[model samples]
Target: MIRSGNPALKESTFLDLGTGAVVSRNAGAMTLNGTVNRTGILLLLCVLTATYTWNTALTPTGELAPGALLYILGGAIGGFILAMVTIFKKTWAPVTAPLYALAEGLFLGAISAMYEVKFNGIVLQAVLLTFGTLFALLMAYRSGWIKATENFKLGVVAATGGIALIYLATIVLGFFNINIPYIHESGLIGIAFSLFVVVVAALNLVLDFDFIETGVEQNAPKYMEWYAAFGLMVTLVWLYIEFLRLLSKLQSRN
Candidate 1:
């Protein structure tokens, strides 16, 4: 018998969607493996982004030209599409991974061009620093020096989410010709916030590592490589941006 208005009813009996009990369990397990492959796919995306950004920033005309805006716009649109595909298409990893990489490359290229012009050699410095931080974090994770407990992971996620919200709000405020004064000129507070964001980004790598280990142990499906790579790419990209911004803020203070 079924009961009405019951939120805790046996979901299997009502919404099983015809998948047998055994298959459902198997599918649930595969999800663990999928996470591993996603990290690998993300690394490939990082390579693509780096290549594009390097070429754009190192060009003869470089950041001085107006043509770079087109690339930025294209990258933005492509990134949105990539996010949609990743979230909605379970089977789209293989196809969408490369596309996301290309789009991210275009976007990074234009942004890097501007930074390169402003800071003069800041691009390479940020790149080297970003990779160094990544390597150090990887070593720490492998050695079990910084275990990401549930609370740690939750805290990072919350902080990252808050940082994202602030960025979005800043973007929206820009349309009204208003800016967050502190983020640009509040001296110690701005530096402190940037430091916090960098820490949060580093912490995300721990979660990524945990996800990869879980996937490998669970023997995730083959397509999961793309998914894992995608996940890593997302984290690395965020980390790199934070690093670059931190450097810029520090340099400005000096």
Candidate 2:
């Protein structure tokens, strides 16, 4: 009954795919250290790919390099596909997770570079804020300062779902030549909305931490280390994007 607001780390994430069985202790079970180490590996892979894409997407002249959009689109689609595959086939996470990280890196790298062109120093600011929030929340959660109570989870899940619906509506409306006002603007309303979203996104990391500890306690299979890492990466990516959006909104106000 492990629950998380992150869609990737849903309830029953560590349960056997079809057997409805719990992992045995001798089955090379998931460990906190192992998951943490694998998370580092995935982060390294993501950073490597992101750096490459950033270099390739932005030329020395500060203009976009050719095929930049391809990197973005390819990464977006490819990362989505790989993530779905990994979710449905958890055993394949040892392979698909790394691929997913690389693809997402490409997508994020290109997007961040473009943002840098419009708002110099924004990318670094976003990265710092993202990781800073991560550490701060982790410390808070580990020290019992923040607990993922049922009410907290429900609130975060509801907020996340609302945000998803808003994004979906925005996309659907775009098809009809309609644009949502204020939400995407740099005005006070937009900034407030972005700040709220950022807080929710950061709160998700708390759920992620609680969820992963539950997985380890359940003795999820060793391969689940990769799956767990993937789930955490998904949250981290979302958080980083929200920070970017929030920072961009604030910068635009200047």
Candidate 3:
């Protein structure tokens, strides 16, 4: 059984979809190539929408335009809702997943532009590092250098859960005007914490890879290609955001 640290791509995601379901022979079973193709499509949609928000967030003077926050909030909240919908209604992924991507792109582009405005060239650095980590880990996983052992999956899942709890606590405490001390600061401990989160996020990609491969092997429904791609996109988005935060922290110190 394949297990992913990503909540969307759980171990049971592909189970039993192959056995007694109504599958169309002409539609074909899920394949790695199909998933890759759908992933590319979703990414293209994301990038296109992202460019819209990215441009909208800036003025000719290169200053942040007013009302950018509207776009950001809209994207964030809309994406969250669509993501929940897609998570529960996997069959609607062909429609909702792309919508989710577009919504998330708006959020990412706005946030990235804000980071770039403060720290010149930080967005490019974060983007390069994000994709670099992705390809490197993909190569490692393919080359058998990194195996998704049971223990590894368990550790990553646990670490991911802990990180989630930490972020949750931090958010909750924020209402009380309390902060998590150095965890969000630019101190050494904060940098270390960000670095650790980035590593765990990267490892989650390996689990995603394993899960997608398992889905293919299990003959999961063809629409699962889109769902699987959506799950991968979720991880990539999280990784990119973490990279942005880490790079910003590092740049602040310099």
Candidate 4:
């Protein structure tokens, strides 16, 4: 069973793909090159939309443009719905994958802009750190220096799940006027927690690489290139957000 730390790239995701299936030529087969190209396309789309929302947030008038918040909320809600749609209907990825990228770009842009406003240049730092981590892990994974063994996958999956649950609990508690600034504060403990989350989030990228490679080896359908690209985007978004949060906490200490 091919496993990944990314929920979107679960164990059974590619189970039914490429098994004794008649694959067409190179173009019809899911190759690493094709997936990389698709990933680049998705990233371009995301960056384009994200730039729009980023500029809208910091309009020339020196204040947030009207409806900035609406875009953010729309992106968040729309992205979630579209993600669900893509997951259940993998064949629809060629259509929904780009849409998901655009939607997430909107959400990421608005939130990142807000963070930038509060902490100058934080967005750049997060972006650089995100890509830096991505390349670093990709290299390590390619070199077999960081193998995603069963135990490794399990540990990362558990860590990711725990972090998700903590955030869920925090949100649930917020409704009762309760808060856990313990993890949001700039103190050592909060910073420590954020660091841990970032590490786990980064580790997910390794699993993503492993998952994509496995898909290729399994001869997954050509469209699965898009699906795999989408999964990588999901992990990248999560890692970028975690980096932003960690940087914000550190900045607050200044």
Which candidate number has the best TM-score? 2
What TM-score, over all chains together, does every model reach?
0.80, 0.97, 0.96, 0.94
* Candidate 3 global CA lDDT score: 0.90
Q: Write the per-residue lDDT of candidate 4 for residues 1-254, one digit (tens) a residue.
A: 66777878986676444454525546476889999999999999999999999998877854666778988999999999999998888788999999999999999988888888889889999999999999999999999999999999989999999999999999999899998878878899999999999999999999999988888887777888899999999999999999999999999989
The lDDT values for all models are: 0.66, 0.91, 0.90, 0.89
> What is the TM-score of candidate 3?
0.96
- Give the best candidate by lDDT: 2
Q: How well is each residue in 40-143 modelled by candidate 3, as lDDT tens digits?
A: 99999899988999999988888787878888899999999998998888878889999999999999888888888889898899889989999999999999
Candidate 1 residue-wise lDDT, 1-254, digit = tens: 21111111111212222442213335543454455445555556656775676575455764446667777788878876886676455356677876887788777767777777777787788789778988898899889898867677667667877887899999999999999988655389888888888888777777776665555554454455565566667676777778778888888866
Steric collisions counted per model? 13, 0, 0, 0
User: Per-residue lDDT of 1-254 in model 2, one digit per residue for the tens?
Assistant: 45677888988788877686768889789999999999999999999999999999998999878788898899999999999999989999999999999999999999888888889999999999999998999999999999999989999989999999999999999999999999999999999999999999999999999999988999888898999999999999999998899899999988
- What's the CA RMSD for each of the models? 7.2, 1.0, 1.7, 2.0
Q: Write the candidate numbers in order of decreasing lDDT.
A: 2, 3, 4, 1
- After superposing candidate 2, which stretches have Cα over 4 Å from the reference? none
